[model samples]
Target: MERILMSLQYNGAAYQGFQIQHDLKTVQRELERITQRMHQQFVRIHPASRTDKGVHALEQFIHFDSHLTLPEDKWMHAFNSALPNDIVVTRVNKVDDQFHCRYDTIGKMYRYRVYTNPLRDPLKVNLMTHMPYDLNITDMQKAARLFEGTHDFTSFCSAKTEIDRKVRTIYLSKVIETTYGFDFVIVGDGFLYNMVRIIVNFLTDIAQGFREVDDVHKVIEARDRTKAHKTAPSEGLYLERTFYSEDELKHCVAELNTL
Candidate 1:
């Protein structure tokens, strides 16, 4: 058997999430079904991240062990032919048996999009979050800087999370103004449930003058979930990219760096 790794992109608006569930549609369920049809056997795929419902992914990674002898160049064409319109396999490669998608990740980058408008745009309804009020971009930028470096993000994660250790390192955090609105790009070593959403909401609160800039430090110091803003809508969150060491993903890093 040989282990193969593939990069995928999907529109999450129509699916439950990345993971499979009984009687529900999901990215994993669709991929697995198509893979089984092609290989004529049960193939279990392990994804790099288990994104929440309504969250999209630009370059999600997955790996599986298979005995099929399909050539590397034809894997993308074969998988894309069987996948639904919403999901596509962008790249594929054979790897050593020791490579594992989830465990081998070094970091990930996520982008949250928000637009300021009086009425929601039908075209962007499932693509971005709408903010009716004007935002203070300067204050929001200040708040984003505070999230950099290592810190315990207990206050910025979903209360439903059962993980005891909430510490994570933020490698990059910045907000960029776009034509219609702004994009919040964050790179982190790892994340907890709803962590990125909560952070975005907190930054929005600060931008709208609902929360003071110093409140970010106060909330982190307090480590209380109740003190944080409500979680942002999942539709605006996108898993931009996942990072691996130079040895693991040498060619992919250059492409991702330009994003």
Candidate 2:
């Protein structure tokens, strides 16, 4: 048997989440169903993260062991043929048995998009969250700078998470005005449940004059969820990338350092 790793790009609107739940549609369940059909046997697939409902991913990683000796390209063609149109396996490769899809991951990049236009676009309702008020991008960017480096993100996370540590490194959190809307890119070592949403809400609040920009420090120091910003809508969030090798990631960091 060979352990194969597959990177998936999925539109999470129709699925419940990544994990399997009774009677609920999930990316993993669909992929597993296809894999089982391809092999004519039951197969278990493991994913790096169980993203919440309505949250999309540009690059999500999953690994599974297959006794069938199929080429990397065939995995995508065969698996996607049986799967739904929204989910696609973009890449597949055979990896070491010791390599875990989740644990071995060093960090992930997520983008939360918000439409700050005066009028909402009908097509973007399912994709981007629309906020009519003009946002102060400068203030928001300044507030986002506070999230950089190592910090205890307990206040920003959702309630009742089981993670032992709340400290996470935020490599970059920038607010950029894109052609369509405002984009918030947060690249971090790891994230807590609803952390990105909460952060975005806080920064957006600061931009909207609902909260003071300096209040971010107060919330961080308090370590209370209520002290932080409210959790934004989940539909705007997308996991953009997940880094695997520490060496590869280090090279990325070094490249970024020179920039």
**Considering every candidate listed, which one attains the maximal lDDT?**
1
Q: Can you give the TM-score per candidate against the true fold?
A: 0.93, 0.94
The lDDT per prediction is: 0.88, 0.86
Model 1, 1-259: lDDT tens digits are 9898999999899999999999799999998887798789989999999999999999899999888888987888988988889898988999999999999998888999998888889999889998878899999988998998899999998889998999999877888788888999888889999999999999999998999999989999989888884899999999988988644343443443454
**In model 1, which range of ten residues has the least summed lDDT?**
248-257
Question: Over all chains combined, what TM-score does candidate 1 have?
Answer: 0.93
Flag regions of model 1 displaced more than 4 Å.
Answer: 246-259
Q: Model 2, stretches more than 4 Å misplaced?
A: 246-259
Clashing pairs in 1: none
